[model samples]
Target chain A: MDKLLVSKRMKGRLVQNAILQAIFFFATVLGLIALMLLLSHVVMQAIGWLDGDFLNNFPSRRPEEAGMKSGLIGSLWLMMIVAPVSFILGVGTAIYLEEYALKNRFTAFIQTNISNLTGVPSIVFGLLGLTIFVRELGLGRSVLAAGLTMSLLVFPVIVVAAQEAIRAVPQQLREASYAMGATKWQTICRVVLPAALPGMLTGAILALSRAVGETAPLVVLGIPTFIAYLPSGVLDTFTVMPLQIYNWTGRPQEEFQHVAAAGIVVLLGFLIMMNSVAVLIRNKFQKRF
Target chain B: MGIPTNQEQPFSVREMIVENQRRQHWPKRMEKIAPKLLFTLAALSVLVTLGILFTLLFETIEFFRRVSIVEFVTSKEWLPWNEEHGSFGVAPLVTGTLLTTGIAMLFAVPIGLASAIYLSEYASERTRRIIKPALEVLAGIPTIVYGFFALTIVTPLLQNVIPDLEIFNALSPGLVMGIMIIPMIASLSEDAMSAVPNSIREGALALGATKLEVALKVVLPAAASGVIASVILGISRAVGETMIVAVAGGSSPEFTFDVTKSIQTLTAYIVQVTTGDAGYGTTIYYSIYAVGMTLFLFTLVMNVLAQYISRRFREEY
Candidate 1:
């Protein structure tokens, strides 16, 4: 009787553990399901609205006539400004910190703050943009102000990436440059940077991809919602895909929501394209060195 | 040993001295400035933080000048748009923020923890590689897209079940935020779980324990602090989320217990007031800064705490 009871208890424990494991397995599967549902719903709703006119024309009061021309052009204008400014500032700061700055308490503190800055809400960066660039500097809500705001927003991500890229150049490469009598700048520019370019570019591309989808910062900068005109210069007012999507979703009309779905598809397409570039660069560089 | 002759010298003394003197006179200034230049660039972040604090504080102080602090914090109604005298109650917004965040954690923790456990212990190497990147891809998707997904897909799916959820109820955004945050919690927890040494798991399994038992009983406790840090950080993100709540959550600010009710959050309120209606120097406009300051402080503390715990008490195997 004792033997039978022990065996029965053991069997029950085994069954309980099996059930527990099965539950966990199902949880992971649920993530894939969520992704599928999100993708399918957006793609299905977007298919009917996405067309040449939708990409080419300006936003209109009429849903059927509206297009994303202003938003597309404005976003391109913003990026044309944002991409270079962020890369130069972010990469320069990273290179200095990694290679030039003396190792001390102040340097450590700076490193900590940079990481902390990344955690601050993007909206706060919008607030800073409005205060410093828009108001203090009198730039208004032009592409320049928005571009500067986005540069700050993605600054830490790129700097951190650049630091990692720079750090990964084998010690021997730096020594070889010095052995050949290269000055500090010459060694960094010719030897360190060449090897680190792939990693730095990969990081820059990823950071810019983040800047592309941001909306809250733009909205907080008070971007006009219904601009039908394309911004032709850095000083002109502009809108991006996410802001346009936000506007469409805000409208009371059901048709606009469908348009928002289409805008999302375009935004997602841009993100995927940029990320692929980063991955491709990373793969090529990894194979070579 | 033979000494080098004058002919073997790389350069004449006169030429070498000339080049050295020229470099010392001009490039010395630039070389001296380069390190300081980089230091200034690094210091720019400090300036940014100061600017944020100053801007928020300046407007918030102006707000308090028109309205008393007691009324701003203690009022029961949040009607700043009233033509005559508006009440600036914070209860509704706070409630909505808490309600959505609570609902988010309810779903986020279990599925997130379970996914972490499965990835760390149960899955084969092939499955782990495929699922991990796929999950990370979810992290890169924008919050605005998630808001639309909540409004379009998840809400309708929930509506089919209950048939009573409000069109702009808090439940939909809350639920979708959970799905949005799953990757954060899972990824961080997976790092923590993976960091737990293999020897601990081997010991547990050798003692006649099942895999599930070993994961839940032994590994979970060992990595408890890290898992907690992940949850806290996830909460901070959910709290700071704007596009998701703003785009999907209703503009109504109501202090109620009903998840089915349409409610406004702190972030959603800021977006609505700033987007179109509010003008500069208005009471409503100033209120956004006050609210923003609150949000900034809240997220700041949570993040600092998370960073502290992850750095301070973290156990290494």
Candidate 2:
């Protein structure tokens, strides 16, 4: 009886283990298959609409005439506004928190609050933009309002990334600078900033990729769908690639699906290029030292 | 030694003048102000939270004036645009959100936890290097694309399998959302598992436990809080997700658990009301903010709980 019980226990254990292993393997395969299928599906649908004209023309009621020039330009303008605001504020916050701030309740409050803001939905940020920037500040869904919203959306992410980067900078470097009579700001500026550039850039690139893909906030901000001309300034109304794609996909027409797929390919390409750079920098330089 | 360095190096008159000038102006002025500037920047995050709170709360209060909180919270139907005597009940929207979120978590939790186990335990570093990034690409793919994928690919495929499946059902969006959040769950769970000290693994293995046993029985339990934290965060993400549900979960606001039926989430409802359909200051327009407030509170609670769990028992090795 004892022998029989022991054998049964072992068998049950073996079966359980095998089942788990199979489940895990299946899960991994599901991830791979989903990725492969998504890419191929988008590519198949996109093949027809991705062309020079698609890149050069503006949004049109006529399906074939529709293009992404204005949206692309609008995205560029948004970036122009977003890049400087986020980086300076984000990196400055990181620098202060890491180097200067005392480890106290207020600092902890800032950290916790920032982390919490990171999880707030993009739509909430949209509301903030609509209230503060569009309504209160009188920017009115222009690129400036949208860009500031995007900045706020990405700000905490950049600060967190910059903190990680700044922290990873060897302590000895800061000590050496200080030993050489450099003040706190001088030490950070001269010694830590350059060392942490690759990391900071990676964070910034990822944040930009996020900004580029965002649509809901823009939608809430009332980014007018069809613009005949490219935006010339930050105050001009604009659309983005994802927003354009969203518009296409929502239409009842069958042909617009193709355009939507093509836009996805462009957005995916943009993301892949940027992510590859981030991965390369991480793998290449981060390990060298 | 430092005092003698200038005389030993025979410091130039121009350098001496420049050094004195720099010492007098740059440090004393900028040094005093730099910290404050950075502090203000850091404090801007606090302001952002305040802004979000004020905006959500202020509008929510406005919404409540027209529609009482009791009516909004306890009513059975949500018909903000019902033309006459529209009910502003949140039950349907909340149910829809929960159903979608539930379905998503049902799919995501297992796959994500399994993948986390595989990556942290089974896969070698070389295999991990190739697979982890591939998985993360799923996370980086915009939700709009995922929404399209669900609308175009998943819903059609489901329709084929289940002929009664609605053109835009909760099932497809839920599944797509599952795939979307797999990276988040896996990465966080993997981090948690990896944090389990190797000594614990050695001890378990030395006791004649199988690798799977070590993972399932020992490491998993050891990392339970962290995994739970990640799952809560994932739940928060699933609940707050907008586009996938909006585009593929259909526009119906039904309070049903049936995944095959069409439904509208809180976010989808917001999108519907806000996309130029409702006029400013109208009840329908204010309804979105009211719903958004509910969502904000739900996610806020989940996020705080997750944060607490992750931080509460952060294991020290």
Candidate 3:
């Protein structure tokens, strides 16, 4: 009886272990499968729309000739504006909080609020942008307005990241700099800022990548569904890649679906390239440290 | 002897003089300026939050004046473009938002929590590192891509299986949104699980518990608060998700609970009104603010709850 009981327990344990292993294996494989499905679906549908004219021409009703040139240019313009503004404001706030502020209730309150802001729905930021930037400020529905909206949407994220990067810099480094008789400003600008630059850059890259892929804020900011011309200025009305894809996908025409897939391929490709560069920079910084 | 002593104290005199001068000027200056700078920055962050609240409130109030609050809240129909017969019932949008978010949480929490358990307890260090970055990649995929995936791929697959699925239904979008948020829950829960002391695991194992038992009975219960917080945050993400719902959840504003039919979320409603030809200053245009205010308030509550739960249950060793 004792021998039978021991063997049964061992068998049950083996079965349980096997089940646990199977669950983990299944999860990992599911993740990979989702990724593969994303890539393959886009590629298979995009190939039919790939041609020379598809790269240079403006968006048209025809699938064989419609290109994302204007949408691409609009995205570039939006990034150019959003990146600098968000970076400066976000990094500045982080430096103040992490380096200068005393640990007090007020500062703690701000910190908590900032974190909450990070959790606030992206759509809320869009609504805020629509009310404040678009209507109250009279920026109108333009690239500048969209960029500003996106900047607000990502501001909290950048600040949070910047704070983390700044916090990760060892206190010993600051002490050593102070011991060298450096002024607070000098220490921050010359020693601390440089040391934290790589992390800050990575954060900025991540935030920008997020902004580039964002569709909700732009959609709420009144991004045009179709724009045949490239934005000539910051205030020029424009369409983004996601909005264009959205427009194409919603059409009943099969041809538009192909174009939408092609747009997805382009958007994903851009995201991958941006992420790769970020990874490269991060690795280089890691090696240096 | 006095002359020799005075000469030997040269270094001390120089250091004392330098320190006295620096302390007199630098410390006073830093003490005066640093607090002010810090206060100003902190104030700015507060101002941003206040600004968002005020902006949403003012516009939302203006919107309510045009459309009665009772009508906006109780009506089941949301047709802003048709001014001749406009009904601004926000219930359907609210229901749709909640249903989709519920579906997303259902998909995200279990998978994410399980993945977190596997990573923290079962996986080797090498596997942990690999999986961590892979999960981050999954998190970093743009919601827009997820939206496209839902519309083009998941929708077609569902149609094949269900045979009656609409071109735009809630299931595919909710599923995709769930997938997008899974990484968030996993990463946060993993952080919580990893923070559990190894001693706890060892104790459970010593009691003849299997690895799975050790994980489920010890680590999960210990990390429950953080896991719950992560789930709340994920739901917040799903509720705010716009593109997927806008694309895959269809454009019809309906209050039905059926996942196979077209629906519209609060965020998607905002997107719809904004994209269409709603003229500036029109009641329809102002209705976006009303919808946005709802979304903002809902998310704000979730966020506050998350912060409260995280702090209240925060464990320290």
DockQ of each: 0.59, 0.72, 0.50
Q: Compare the candidates by lDDT and give the number of the best one.
A: 2
Q: What is the lDDT of candidate 1?
A: 0.86
Task: Tell me candidate 2's TM-score on chain B.
Answer: 0.93
Which is the better candidate, 1 or 2, if ranked by DockQ?
Answer: 2
Give the alpha carbon lDDT tens digit for every residue of B87-111 in model 1: 8878788888888998999999899
What are the per-residue Cα lDDT tens digits for candidate 3 across B154-245? 89998999998998888889888888888899889999889989998899899878888888888888887788888888888898888889
Q: Considering only N, C-alpha and C atoms within 3 Å, which residue pairs clash in candidate 1?
A: none
- Binned by DockQ into CAPRI classes (incorrect, acceptable, medium, high), candidate 3 is medium
Query: What is the DockQ score, from 0 to 1, of model 3?
Result: 0.50
TM-score for all models, in order of appearance: 0.93, 0.94, 0.92
Q: What does candidate 1's lDDT look like per residue over A140-192, in tens digits?
A: 98999999999988978989999998998888889999999766776787898
**Segments of candidate 3 deviating more than 4 angstroms:** A1-3, A287-289, B1-42, B81-85
The candidate maximizing DockQ is: 2
Error of 2 at A61 (Å): 1.7
RMSD, every candidate, angstroms: 3.5, 3.0, 5.0
Docking class of 1: medium
For model 1 the local lDDT of residue A227 reads 90
Query: lDDT (0-100) at residue A56 of candidate 1?
Result: 93
Clashes of 3: 1
